[model samples]
Target chain A: MLLVILELVGIAVFAASGALAAVRARLDVFGVTVLALATALGGGVIRDVLLGVHPPTSLTKWPYLLVPALTGLLVFSFHPQVARLRRAVQLLDAIGLGLFVTGGTSTALALGAPPYTACLIGMTTGIGGGAMRDVLLREIPLVLRREIYAVAALLGCLVVAGGSVLGLPEGPVALAGSALVVAVRLLALWRRWNAPVAHGLDA
Target chain B: MLLVILELVGIAVFAASGALAAVRARLDVFGVTVLALATALGGGVIRDVLLGVHPPTSLTKWPYLLVPALTGLLVFSFHPQVARLRRAVQLLDAIGLGLFVTGGTSTALALGAPPYTACLIGMTTGIGGGAMRDVLLREIPLVLRREIYAVAALLGCLVVAGGSVLGLPEGPVALAGSALVVAVRLLALWRRWNAPVAHGLDA
Candidate 1:
């Protein structure tokens, strides 16, 4: 039940981010909806596909699809108000990242994927949607640029994988992993932390 | 046997286009290689995943992985010379698009997908890699922007699905479908045919 709530919240927050990006790009309504759906569900769909799960749950489940659509509509209608709360949106995005990374890692492990693959998929799941959103908006992905986003995801994955290896209970392990990601991401934001750029390539 | 050859050819041509795009973006060698691999195998991998095939043949098969890597290296070293034959490269890209579309549609049909779903998957397979390449390079996807590219792919998919519905032999059906796509795409190029953009949004 908690996981389900987390999943919905993550989808809503991610969808909002996507809708904001679309507004920034001055996209039409259709474009806004497409970006919202892609941002909220693209990562999970990719992960499910990688795990050989057909008809990705996001596509088949009504709530998963509806949440993003509604979120997009809401954002489209009230973007000016939403834009003023950008800091809150960023915090929500960080929380979404944590939720998604933990959920992805646990799901991959349950499906019998190797630990390394699970970790990779977890990180991908946490970052893939935003990357797709940025790509569609014709911007370099933020995960590949500023902040410790991918690193935080990687840490979450590591925590989950390590806990599984140590025979930890699934519930506690997932909670710990998610908390770690959220904490790290929040700290990074608080400190204005940025990933190091390649030497001589900082322009 | 025929499919294998066609797949390799498609990968090579797609990788070449990706490499050229990376060059145009002034990306480093690592970026070029990454783009090449993504462009060459991204579509097929997405198709396989959607079909419930795990690990994707491209990742498991040595030759499949090697072909794109080698293509990237070759382009990185000889791009100036290769860039001179722009017309030839464009022709090869058309061939690759046709091959991938027919191949993807047939594969989806063989997997027992409905005709509509198969056609959608086929079009996705034909354009997914190039879209990913463009996204990675921070450009709007060409398929979504200009030309009769996606239309050509959709037509190929329709031909394949229609042939399957008629219970035609797979080999002949695939051949005819691919040939149609290549012919249409080449003609579009020669005639400078482009999909109409929304008025007042052409920038």
Candidate 2:
């Protein structure tokens, strides 16, 4: 299916970002692969576990592991080419984020998740890997502190859900949803937008 | 009651180690507390989640959070005194490791886990926090290499299981197991001992 191809492309992009980050941090080959695996599959693993699906999609399939490992290895071998196009990497990352959020939302919805829960899962699926990567790297996560990260995922989820409720075809719905998320993220990054900082008594 | 005390002591010692490591890592106050919390309670959290226990014990008990947070704050304020005796910290860490392994193994056994699974859980309970810390710090885990490491936990689990099958009182059995692990780790450290390495396979 076209959707499946899009999903795989998204995964490859996400995994490459993880590998690139590890390389930038001076991690070895093993570490690069580990980070890529975590970044590409971490969100889905958490979602599956919470949904009570044992063995998870990653463990149930070989491509899930092989793809990320290969992506990391490839990125590591060709770091110079990738490093020169930082902007291109960011654009790909945003596109991957959009695709993943749509996939996660629709998957949860099809599995009979409540709307709010589906929305949460979708957002978590979109940003969870990046959060895990940042935590492991001892850095404040950019999504949590800087941009409209989870918000973009949520918007994508809303668009997909809205289209589904109107009996739209999944392909167009997913495409629209992904485009919305990618556009919002690109705009937010360009404008240096951020969520409001909480005051001393906010909590 | 003694076992409970030992568990609490283990938590406290690990909390201290977490705080010290956070300080050394140059984290902020909140970051220090977060590190301390993960170091002190992360193993139990993973155990409870894997066992399908809802609202893990660490969340149910306020002291579990309070103690580690307070420990981090204290260390943040008085780093000089704590840093003066690094050996004392190492000793406490070893004692905590013994208690954690013994406690986790017995808990798993009591919960009807198989012996090998119980032993694995025991090792995880003892070193899970440090492993998490290392992973988060973007390095190979110390537990995976160097010193006696997981061997201490494995030996302790054997003792605990053997004593339990022999109808020994839980108290004496746990105490003996804990002592054995502490002694093994101490002697190993004193002799600069390590598990055998396969050439070209350290990675």
Q: Identify the leading candidate in terms of DockQ.
A: 1
Please list the Cα RMSD from the true structure of every candidate, rounded to 1 decimal place: 6.6, 8.2
Model 1: per-residue Cα lDDT over A1-203, one tens digit each: 98898999999999999999998899999899999999999889878878877778899989999999999999999999999998899889988998899999989899887676687678778888998898878786676455677678989999998998989998898889888998888898999876432223222
Kindly provide the TM-score of model 1 when superposed on the true structure, using C-alpha atoms: 0.62
For candidate 1, write residues B31-116 as lDDT tens digits.
56666878999999889877877756675566776788799878877787778899999899999999999999988998899999
Relative to the real complex, the DockQ score for model 2 comes to 0.07
Q: How far does residue A131 in candidate 2 sit from its true spot (Å)?
A: 2.7
State which candidate has the highest lDDT.
Answer: 1
Candidate 2 C-alpha lDDT tens digits along A1-203: 78777877888888999888777766656557667877898777677667655335554465776788899888877777887798999899999999988888888888888767877888888888888777766677878786888788889999987877777897888899999999999999899888988688755
DockQ values, each candidate: 0.17, 0.07
Cα shift from native, residue B69, model 1 (Å): 3.4
Please report, as a value between 0 and 1, the fraction of native contacts recovered by candidate 1.
0.29
Best by TM-score: 1
